[model samples]
Target: MSARDGLDADERHLLVVDDDDRIRDLLKKYLSRAGFRVTAAADAGQARKLMSMLDFDLMILDVMMPGEDGFSLTKSIRARPGRQTPVLILTARGLPDDRIEGLALGADDYLAKPFEPQELLLRVEAILRRAGPRPVVQRRLSLGPCTFDVERGELSRDGKPVRITEAEAQLLRTLAKAAHAPVDRLALAPDATDATGRAVDVQVTRLRRKIEADPKNPRYLQTVRGVGYMLAPDE
Candidate 1:
């Protein structure tokens, strides 16, 4: 297997929301190098925006921020519809009640500040392992005017070949394999080095432009809130 295959075999995507620039940057760098995809946000506002666009396997939230603290944010995320992406709250305050509150609000785990990076990594791995593996996917898909062959990694629209970049082809194949199921952005990444899953997002946009009548409001290539992209092929 290649190095990328060995490193973060699952390619889980993580979101780190913290007001502390130093902390956020450190976590992003550390997590990225460790083989997992990481995205950082300065505050709840930025986190919400990121969450709206990308699907994350886990979220690391710093409990104290200027607006909408981690606790409140966690509550809001759980209240939202669809999959509740696992949340790991980080706080300087190590109070038992704080941990209880976070858990009650739907957080999967809690880590106090000044934690060892290794411990955090281990916790993340444990949480994901518990989240379970993605379901098996179908081999073929029908997307309105488009038909995708997962094994061949080919897409055709209206009985005509629709040219796609190698990157787009790979992404389509991944999504096709998991048709009707949410595929995490990181899992669809062309390579392991795409730690932020930004490359995957770009490819999805291009694919939507070609497949959807209106890319802005996609029907087949849909975003599963708090999860990732799902290909809703015709039955």
Candidate 2:
């Protein structure tokens, strides 16, 4: 429950993106009281604007938006470079297939509409724990021109903070620990969820944007084709 100021840089900043005003306000208030710097977005457009304007540690996106649904938006983020933030999909769909679709689009977690706030808090905390950013990094790691601090989950270049998606942070931590070993797509799925192979591919695509200088021909995070995915040498 720590923050960047008094706590650590590893503290999480949350964005709650939903079309429903009541849900958004409630989540923002509740998450704030739980020690998160939260922002709200009514739709994909506003979420895009907020993304353009600020950095969020994690994003909670509603699947049923007006134009750009959460899946579509997740696809857009996956397509871009330097934006690998972690995403959690919130929807009424409890179907495994529906959850798979959201995960395939690069969402890290999924929760149904009638979910408990405490459970939501737990999920949020779990995602943040993966990245471990906010307070400060205890160790320093070098990745090409950029650097990642595993303990703090912060990535920086030349002493300047570089914005990375929460997904990116999670990937970096995962790959960093594995070093040169390849991490399977299934290995990246949310702890308690059953995710399909397609879902893993989406997460990898989104992660490449933040980690690879050339997402098309990634050097650091690489694909093993049939074998699965692995982290290229950090150097």
Candidate 3:
């Protein structure tokens, strides 16, 4: 297996370097909601500072900045003694040569500007998935009357195992990672399936049956109206 296959969704850290304030903030918020710890930098200088302080899993860079453009910084990163962090470059320059230059400078992937956030997310996932599989850390999450163990893929209440399907376990793991935050249904199911939104709703309903004391009025797993589902684990 390639190094990318080892990366798990949880515990992935990203560094987003962009000069545009709006794009930087938007990507930061969006990726954070998607269950990744994202740190933003306004330019190459700030990116260098952050890189010196932290070890990031991946980086999202913009090419056309005021100074020290993405290509130069990518080349510098590649030249570093032991820095092989995956990089995905974003720029308004859509020329074939521009993409070639970015990739040649050690970028793992490149996307032109005016792209959909969903598409950007898919690219990020794709790049990270290629790195390698990450070790699965066992964690026990509290949900009012029950405890869900991520490593064992088991849920128990009052010392008894509560039967749950594999799909349900996967859904719970995804939600538990971002507890108290709304998770988009599209993030839950990325495949081109018909009526995916409705399908996620069905899955949520089934999950409620196993966890909620009253499925009609859930306590821990609550729907955020037009947004999506949020897991408010018991404190």
Candidate 4:
């Protein structure tokens, strides 16, 4: 039986960042065969650029790159505001301290060089499994006095229809879909050409005004520090 027998390879995308072209290509080919869409970056700079534009299910990073090593890259990634994509550190440094540091820096797993391809595939699968599936968005969400119907992208306050722009409705639906989980600002403004997430911030502010009793201190549309915004619905 094939390792990827029942897996949906087309859905999960992986980013492989390594300085060595040979190892990077080999890993990409092997993982692709194992049922995953793969993209490769030669260094942290390239990896960062790719991350800004595309979302990846997981990252395979080499720890010994020339500029901004894997450890540093991992730290920066964790510190940044947005999705905390799972990372697996692949490196020649197999020492105890190295592994400890990688985990401490928020890496999902650590694998030393001279490792078997089968072992690597297993580790990748394990990490993806641990990350779990995406949260299922409820059709209806309660935000204090305001209730949102995700299916219709409609918001009502105290059983009365609330006036909202199409843009606001779209934003609210996006937030409601993630309900309680932080939705990346970029993800919120999928149509906006602006990459700074300013458009998302504006939309959130507008949505909060309608749904929050105190827009100054939002209760439902809450900001996630160093991440994005989360929709905390009333139970």
Please report the candidate that would top TM-score against the real structure. 1
Best by lDDT: 4
Residue 49's lDDT in candidate 3: 60
State, as a TM-score between 0 and 1, how close model 1 is to the true structure.
Answer: 0.61
Question: What CA RMSD would candidate 1 show?
Answer: 9.7
lDDT by residue (tens digit), candidate 3, 111-213: 9999999899888888887776543333888888889986666899987999987767777776765677887775554331755578778889998888899
Sort the candidates on TM-score, descending order: 1, 4, 2, 3
TM-score of each: 0.61, 0.55, 0.55, 0.60
21: Cα error in model 3, Å = 0.4
Q: Write the per-residue lDDT of candidate 4 for residues 1-235, one digit (tens) a residue.
A: 3436544556688999999999999999999988899999999988876665456789999999998899999997786544578999999999999999999999999999989999999898888777776334577788888888876778899999998877777777666655678877776764468999998888888888898999999989999988789989987
Candidate 1 clashes between residue pairs 3 or more apart in a chain or in different chains: none
Candidate 4 has its poorest 10 consecutive residues by lDDT at: 1-10
For 1-235, candidate 2 gives per-residue lDDT tens digits of 5443343433567888999999999999988887778889999888875564456788999998898898898777665443378889998878899899989888899999899998998888777777655533236677666678766668886778878766656656666555666656654543315566676677678766766688999887788776567765545
The local lDDT score (0 to 100) that residue 191 gets in candidate 1 is: 37
List runs of model 2 lying over 4 Å from the truth: 1-11, 135-235
lDDT of 3 at 163: 91
lDDT at position 116, candidate 1: 99
lDDT of 1 by residue, 1-235 (tens): 3213433534678899999999999999888877888899999988876665456788999999997899999997786544668999999989999999999999999999889988888788777777776333456688898988776667899999999887787777656655678877876652347788888888889999999999999999999877779888899
